[model samples]
Target: MPSTLFGFTITDHKKVFAIALPMILSNIAAPMLGLVDTAIIGHLPDAIYLSAVAIGAMVVSFIYLLAVFLRMATTGYIAQSFGADNLAEQRQHFNHGLTLAIGLGIAIAIASPWIIDFSLWVVQPDAALIPYASTYIGIRLWSAPAALTILIALGVLLGRQQSGRAMWLAIITNAVNVMMDLVLIIGLDLNVAGAAWASLIADYVTALVGIYWCAKALNWTPALLKIIPDKLSQYLNVNGNIFIRSLVLQLCMATMTGYAARYGSDIVAVNAVLMQFLMLISLGLDGIAYSVEALAGAAKGQQQPERIRYWCKLTLVWSCIFAVFYSLIFWLFGAQIIGLITDLPEIINKAENYLPWIILLPLVGHWSYWFDGVYIGLSLSKGMRNTMILAAGFGFLPLWWAGMPLQNHGLWLALSGFLLMRGLFQALWLRLRWRQVV
Candidate 1:
């Protein structure tokens, strides 16, 4: 038994690390891909190319993000099923999740034009970059199904405690993306269009490999899937919860980007670069959240409620520690860090002023990130979705509206408030689980 934190003993740190290490690697690879994309695009003759890439990437992230439920819901179901010692149930979870991923992927791909149009409207792309952004987004949209399906399949593997395979898949996928980006963007001089094509090709390749591994690793069978009564219903129920959560979350993000746009192209580009850096921090910390999801869900399914509670306490403590560490890092290296990514001295100067907000973001937002794992592990999808919607409406939108007249400083204030609001709202929601536990 581990020692207590506020009357709850922490679970095995080794266990947490076992799951988190590979996930951390995978998460790191994801942001590195973005950095590479930005790096390759940033070097182009015009900065507007990077801006186009930004809008294009944001469009995909916002629209396709709804399909994320595959991984999110699958992780919880598989974890709980593993804990329950229900191998068949575990298999069923994967099948249903994969099914949902494929279905949603197809639907989104078919409706890509509509989704792209809506996203363009939301972002309100400028005339200079609109054509470039549309071209990039249009090409990338074709890969939507492949990208989303792979995410869910990988999620199932992670839930089954096969984090190693997921990590390998992520590495291979991202590596291919980087190689293709270099070939298409720079070597071939295809510009933003090339970058989008690279992602599209990489996604299909990844999806194919992921499916092969999943079949081999799980020894998947139709009979195992048959064991699940109302499999489709269960999948929809779980997926619906996650869809709502991601939709609201993406809206908040899209709106934040919109706010940055209001400050003009220079601010948008600077913020986009800063956002890439912040992503590095957030995704790295998300390793803990990923581990907690699998471990806690498994514990819950096994009726080891104590284990779930213990892991939660342990992860939260470590997250706070990492937050402080990351803040110090940002403070110490802020100038050199921003300078490394771009030649635009003005953008770097503005980013320096905004660096403090970026540093503070992770620490304040850590709670929501950690609690996301807790909720996913417990399969409390509805509650998670509801809380996000509530937070976006009450906490974020209000502050954003109020700060509109204040310009850049006011913009930073609103965005900071948004991050802080998510933390505060989710913190309150986490306490509600006390009743669920006791």
Candidate 2:
């Protein structure tokens, strides 16, 4: 009743839900929103539109992931500054982060045309698909500045525990996107490019909203503060490590997708559906993880060791409950859930066969999500990067190679094992070196 964990009063466990619930609810509704996008594409007469958009989205997402450090570093530094009650440092972090985001985003937009073309050429999907995918990607890249700027704003808000506003930011963007989808795709017959237009307009719109919220929340001063050389070095160090972690992750996933293609078209389709389910799970768990980053990071910044431990335990407790809830839903109604994506008997049957892995994934994988927040709170991403490298290089690749004979099933096994390894390594490092970092 007191939000106590083992005699330590958390002082605000309920606030964890206050933070996580909106995101969780957003996760629930997010699928339906995604369905609208899918349905629009599904109804289009030419299937090449779907393929074009998919390839373009995939390449852009993987490439833009390089900028994730903008959000993550902002969250870590801003949260600690909030806890320490250092308003100047918070403003400095915001100014620095915004500038960095805008700068990197512009670079991507200006320079990525050749990169996109080269990547597509390497993939060599089809002669017919080249023009369509190129057009979609070309328009989408121009929005990079606005998109990355929005990422910084969301990080600033979340670090200040303004998750409710962050949720609305996402909703407003998606709402505008769907409306544009209706207008351009259905009414105007823009087809594949319409989807790209919807996203482009929505990003710039939300970017404006993101800027407004950040300006008000952080409330910048009249005189802009310059980033310190020493401070920039430290920030880049953490950010660079995170970049390595992201690179390894994206490569492994790409490799997995490539292997999935080898099995057959249906297997490829089934893996795609299952990944949607995985995305849903990550979104839900990430809510609690976000809570940990804010609350525990505050505790660490305030030099309250007991509170840090308390927040960690409290969030873990809630994450486990949600993980169990998700597993049960996936287990009992796995077939029904698969049905939401496709009516084809063959794909449905194939997905259900592998549903067991999806159910177990949360149970094993939830640990890493929780600890990722813990390390982020400490602003120590080096551990995270190291552990991921080990997991990807040591756990996933070896297991995947050995299980090659099992084909798709082997791939799932390696993925599940890889996740479990990341959690264990992070936990062990924290246990052994907790005192030094904190």
> After superposition, which runs of candidate 1 have C-alpha atoms over 4 Å from their true positions?
1-11, 33-55, 116-136, 179-197, 222-229, 435-438
Model 1, 67-185: lDDT tens digits are: 77788988888888887888767777777776666677777778878877887887787988888998888888888778887887778777877888888888877778888999998
| Clashes found in each candidate (C-alpha, N, C closer than 3 A) | 0, 0
lDDT by residue for model 2 over 263-354, one digit each (tens)?
99999999988997788788879899889988888887788888788888888888898789889988998889899988999999999889
lDDT of candidates 1 onward, in order: 0.79, 0.84
Count: clashes, candidate 1 = 0
What 10-residue stretch in candidate 1 is worst by lDDT? 4-13
Best by TM-score: 2
